[model samples]
Target: MLPGVVGTIQATEAVKLLLGIGEPLIGRLLTYDALGMRFREVRLRRDPKCPLCGTAPTITDLAVHRNGAGGACDVSPDGHPEGVAAAVAPKAGG
Candidate 1:
């Protein structure tokens, strides 16, 4: 049931994007609470300090991925893209 609902939403969004009709959730996140039967929309903002889309992006090309896993541009040996910062949460009480 949850998969059906989520799939329908994804299909609808794809159709809207292909047809260029109606407002699509581009930078907004749609969260569904199945237990409470509620839906919430969260507007996302671009982080200026982000390495990918930041004002001064360090990674401007995909050349770093050339030496990825088996030279397949999948992922580096470090389990993250080269020249990009890996998202790591701070340890609790560290």
Candidate 2:
């Protein structure tokens, strides 16, 4: 949800709510397996250019590419070799 929006609950609030009911999960790692069962926490990284929560300028849209072999790349807003379709495609009938 957009920050500062009315009636929008923040992540901190959500965590607090869970903790209030004896389900405190702060600092506790959580993970899911291929069967969708809770497992353990794994290492993760924060993208400096993530549109949702990054230091770079916000991006309105994102383009995704894959090689059908589990390999993928996340393109940024700026035009780059990895950004094949950063901008929206023109309407075909327009």
Candidate 3:
């Protein structure tokens, strides 16, 4: 799981660069106080070998499907649709 500090830093940097409304403070920590709560500091991480953000050049799309039973199905590599059974609740009498 990513630390909340990382998310906050990314969000703040994005807002500062894109909107140019707030001052960009990379080294110093920023705090948010709201609704009787307070938050402090932010952290950031980078994906070294991530295809989307790295030097590699390979990409794939994940297609998701839902059947009539309201269950999700994933398409296999061989182009076959893998069916997932829906969870059913047993009757009280049974």
Candidate 4:
């Protein structure tokens, strides 16, 4: 039920954006409170340092997806498998 509601909102927003018919949710956050049956909107500010949306974005290319070794799916930047820690602490007085 919750997912359906969110998906409908997202689809509606996409249509509005493509047609430029009504105001979109750009630069804003829309939150749904199912328990309270309420919806709230909050203005959002763009961060200049954001990796994907920043002034000088580093993720502008698709190189990350082409690697194939986890690529975009790899959560760790250190090349460790997902859910595995990159480093482990030394044993006390090892």
Query: Against the correct fold, how does model 1 do in TM-score?
Result: 0.62
Q: On a 0 to 100 scale, what is the lDDT of residue 65 in model 3? A: 25
TM-score of model 2 (CA atoms): 0.29
Assess candidate 3 and give its TM-score to the true structure: 0.28
Tens digits of per-residue lDDT for model 2, 1-94? 2233212334555767867854434444343343554345433345456655567745444533234533334443462333213333323331
**What lDDT score goes with residue 22 in model 3?**
74
* Candidate 3 lDDT: 0.46
- lDDT per residue as tens, model 4, 11-88: 999999899898899877787768999997766677665556767777777787888866554433543222212123
Ranking by lDDT: 4, 1, 3, 2
Worst 10 residues of 3 by lDDT: 80-89
Best by lDDT: 4
Clash count for each candidate, listed in order shown: 0, 0, 1, 0
Q: Which model, 1 or 4, shows the larger lDDT?
A: 4
Give the top-scoring candidate (TM-score).
1
Model 3 ranges with Cα > 4 A deviation:
1-36, 60-94
For model 4 the TM-score comes to: 0.61
Ranking according to TM-score, highest score first: 1, 4, 2, 3
List the RMSD of every prediction in angstroms.
9.0, 14.2, 14.4, 11.9
Candidate 4 local lDDT, residue 38: 93
Query: What lDDT score goes with residue 34 in model 4?
Result: 85
| Shift of residue 65 alpha carbon in model 4, Å | 4.6
lDDT of each: 0.66, 0.43, 0.46, 0.67
